[model samples]
Target: MGFESVPSLPLEGLETVDAARRPVPASPGTTTTPGAADRAALRTDSARANGAATASPAPPDLKVVPLPVRRAEPGRDTPAAGRSSIIVLLQQVQEQHGYLPRPEVVRCAGEAGISVAQAYGVASFYNFFKLTPPGQHTIRICQGTACHVQGAQGLLERVQSELGIQPGETTPDGLFSLETVACLGACSMSPAVVIDGEVFGRVTSRQVPRILARYRRRK
Candidate 1:
């Protein structure tokens, strides 16, 4: 006998599962999808890793080094300090040679580390520093105010004529060297003439020949 089939169950009362909505098992080296905060954190971490791998090594510690200082040697002076010594050296050379000879002056300038012109300038400026050799006797005629008022010009002319030389020249016989001085400190005896260190004051034009004859007769 055929029996009537029971009615099919209602699909509305049963639950259904979708394959796409189900949780999946993760494979090796696979991760789940990250949220916004997690994605930001992962990017920061990746950037830091890359920067660390490509960065240069740190430099060594810096040190300050001082340079060496130089000290001057003993008894050695600078060029500026040595200028004053030049005068002293020149005086000594003049004392040794009696006059500043050209060769001696050059030698002195070399010793003093100065120029030849400088030494010559010093030599020529001072009246005491004679350039030419002096004769056996030196005659200094005074031309001070007292002597000038007392007819010293006449006495000078007489001396010049008798010696056959100027005021700054030596005689051909090498006996007398003539020079003119500003003062002889003998104002009381004006018109003074000094011959070989002897002061002859109140000298007239006639007395010049007699005074020079005394020195000429001397050995």
Candidate 2:
């Protein structure tokens, strides 16, 4: 089954807790809703300051994730980490892991001093974030004007037949997920298909089988 859509959240800034014993202060314009974990992070910080034992931060081997841009709405709060900062964090997580896990969302939200609801909201608002696990290969077909003129229709059909899945759907084997994009900003490469970020321009129906074969072998 397809993933459930993410819920909407208040556009708010990240939450900040004092590393020192100072009560966790919410930076101006930041909305703070202290969760049990947030309180725990604070306790951990205090313990470490007082020479009590605490687990070291997660290893540096953490993955990079790609996050979405925060749209500035009238009611949105500005986080101390700022919108750009959170987006950068999300991007780093996605880049390293290929998908954003719920804990990462909570971690990122906590780091930003934002609530889990806000973090999940931001992650879900953009198409870039994959709350659900994705296939090994992500196939993006261009539906842009130039591509459309250059026989993207045929390419789409070929993709459907080859993968036995439509756009926005993943293969039964979970090897690939097909997506239609308006523009990949590669107008010169109209009728293009991107398999795992490698663009194949001027794709034709004849080439679809070969391309599918190429990806299927990786499975």
CA lDDT for candidate 2: 0.73
- Candidate 2 lDDT, tens digit per residue, 43-120? 678778989676444213233344455543323445533444456678889988877888897777766666778777
Query: What is the lDDT, from 0 to 100, of the residue 24 in candidate 2?
Result: 58
Q: Rate the local accuracy (lDDT) of all candidates.
A: 0.71, 0.73
What lDDT score goes with residue 105 in model 1? 80
In order of appearance, the predictions have TM-scores of 0.59, 0.52
Best by lDDT: 2
How does model 2 score by TM-score? 0.52
Identify the candidate with maximal TM-score: 1
Model 1 lDDT tens row, 163-214: 9999777888888888998888898999998887788989999888788889
Residues forming the 10-long window of minimal summed lDDT in candidate 2: 58-67
